[model samples]
Target chain A: MQETIEKVTKVVKKKRAKFPESYIHDIARAAERHDLDDDELDELVRRVKRAYERAKVEKGEAVGTVAAQSVGEPGTQMTMRTFHYAGVAELNVTLGLPRLIEIVDARKKISTPTMAIYFEDEFKNDEEFVRTIANKIGKSNVNDILQDFHVNFAEMNVVAELDETKIKDKRLDFTDIINRVEKAFKKAQIDNNILSFVPSKSNIRELRLLADKVRDLQISGVKNIGKVVIRKEEDEWVIHTEGSNLGAVLKMEGVDKVRTTTNDIHEVEKVLGIEAARNAIIHEAQRTMDEQGLTVDVRHIMLVADMMTADGSVKSIGRHGISGEKASVLARASFEETGKHLLRASIRGEIDHLTGIIENIIIGQPIPLGTGSVGVVMKHK
Target chain B: MKHEMVPDHAVLSKSESNKVLKKMDIHLEQLPKIKSDDPVAKSIGAKEGDILEITRKSSTAGKFITYRLVKD
Candidate 1:
């Protein structure tokens, strides 16, 4: 083993390519396993060296442009419609081009916010337990629990008749609903599953406004999470929610916090910080592309994600984010709002160093990329 | 086989991380980054600017060491 290692090291040292130590060790092990003589070992080392040399990226290669083209070209081929989630008919997710645009734009509120919540080990297979957890995570308003709402214009009061069956089905107490409504409106009165709201002054408009407020009042569960559909996948049950409330859902008991993911990027940012948000952008973009049978490299997604979150926050690719905030005045102007950007820069006495690609391109010059990145210096002897 | 079963991951000390940076002749930003919220980064409590050393089992070599900068 020692002799083989020594021969491999000697051959690697002589090679021009800077092969990693692991590669050298690998060659030595393979040579030993084959029981190769000195000549065979040397040939093996040479082949490994050649492969390493071939694998390395060449200097002055326009990587950024290549990455952009690789991603953008396939992006044009992505589907334009929202896709129905697998197994669940009612649940739909914004996929393809719109989703890609949303990710790049770093939009705070997504068109259809969704969450896939997995349960902990104890509650994983228990359908009843999972259903209870889903109910807890789902937002329930007074209108959702109430069967009928009657208005007594003469008395200037609104009466909400609570659904007894729904309250029982959801495992919610009638008093709990009453208490919640009472907290929102002081003049609320409870009588045998009938919650009444009396206006201070007897008026039709005031009664109508009070009734609207009472109808929209959230009685229980996490806010913004409207519907949760629990589906059994193999042995375990997963909760798929229509509305995403990542912050609240994560804190809930029986929830597998680590695996639970939401479609809303900003919600993820708020709950898990900017780094998690960057990951979400990458994961979401890749998933969108993959679902449409488009294959873009993971590194491209990483590069885009890194650029989006480089400033410790998620920023859109276009103006009002990364492009608009460029160091060079001309680069900013060239991206969007050319007149406004140029005017502002001139008024502020800003100078363009012609550093970025866009700025250089606008002035009809070779951009500082590839061969144009460096300038030759003449030496006087 | 045991070593291959579990790849070793460790957080480099401040001085060790600096030495790595010096040896590579690269700034922290130049290194490939891993998010601070990454599972491995979180396990070691690796903050932004911290360097993580991951040693993976290799078939050719006994082990292969790689470094990643933890970023926000």
Candidate 2:
């Protein structure tokens, strides 16, 4: 079977000069399932060539308008609430329309920031290693590792009883916890595994307040990583985090830095640069549309992503971003705050060049797109 | 630098850049801009004002080609 497939693939490659590489590859793969002779293979290639030609866009096609309609039509049908991310009830993420809006708006701070952390090749399938990394990444407060906090009004101090089992389970050092507590509270005293701190006022209220602070103090793990869920995705163990800290997560050992991604667009930009941010926008918008069972083409999302990141930094789709930054005064005025834009343009003596689509449409001229984009040239002999 | 999200970027030499600009019938300022400090630009040692040919894999077009001028 393998030999036959290879022979068929070779034959397809020989005739792939006219067709696209992807088209040829697809045809070859499809040919593998069927047992076809030379005649049938040649016929299949001929039909694919015709179909490929028909599928291409014409020179004067209005692709931008089509892309806009393709994305916007399905966007109206999306749901509008936070939902559990990928069946992980512990991690709630904003999905559907809200998520799509968040992606296109290029919001700096997302409502539910999450990271999908993959591991290095050796540890990808190792469940034990994944759990350890999750523990190291997930934020843990002092309350999580302590059995109970005893507020002693008589002694004018709060004593925290450490849970040794939990500490060891989290792979945290006892001394590290004590040091953090001492640094936070100048009067903190550490004895063996016990941490006690006396409030300066030395009253019942002060003791209770100090105990509360001690309980809530962060003991270990990376900050902003609220919860970590380890689930096996296909052959490997994948870690899904509630809160994202991409910078810190990428720096950790045994992490596959290339594959690990966060839903936070701005954070991705800050960490990986604009191109990664553009890809993030595409992936996120596509995922959002897919999650809602909407079938908007990827090209539309790609176009939107390209526009947002065209200026080296990610910008929002609406006002204060791409729409507001248009070169034409009439175009900007037409998008939003017509009065403000026109007033500002007039004050600055901005010229309306009528170079773009909206400006041309506003002035009763044919929009400079599709068939209307080109002008006739006359020659006098 | 080897990230899957980032497309393949190659710096165009002075002559090649001039030819590309002439072929496209556009000025250097008309092309999309990439910051000099952009991760991929920095990794590929692209200096300011250099034209980069970016090749991206597209679901629709199979392969899409674009250009960016590195800017400080």
Lowest lDDT sum, 10 consecutive residues, model 1 chain A, at A80-89
Predictions in order: lDDT = 0.78, 0.83
Q: How well is each residue in A1-381 modelled by candidate 2, as lDDT tens digits?
A: 456545655665676635544665566667776766778877887677678778877876878789989999998888766664665767888888888888888888889998899998999988878888888888898999888778877778888889999988887778887878878988878888787888888678877887889889987778778888888888999999988888888889999988999999988887787778888898999988888888988878888998998888889998989888888888888888999998998899998878888888777888777779789999988
Candidate number of the best TM-score: 2
What is candidate 1's CAPRI-style docking category based on DockQ?
Answer: incorrect
Task: State every prediction's TM-score relative to the real structure.
Answer: 0.77, 0.89
Model 1: pairs clashing at backbone N, Cα or C within 3 Å: A26-B60
Candidate 1, residues B1-72: lDDT per residue as tens digits? 111112455789999999999998998887666677754567668888888786744433445676778877
Instruction: Record all residue pairs in model 2 with backbone atoms less than 3 Å apart, i.e. clashing.
Output: none
Task: Please compute and give the TM-score of the first chain of candidate 1 against the native first chain.
Answer: 0.82
The whole-model C-alpha lDDT of candidate 2 against the native structure comes to 0.83
- Report the C-alpha lDDT of model 2 over B1-72, residue by residue, as the tens digit: 555676789999999999999999999999988889887888899999999998887776577678999999
Candidate 2 to truth, TM: 0.89
- Scored by DockQ, the top model is 2
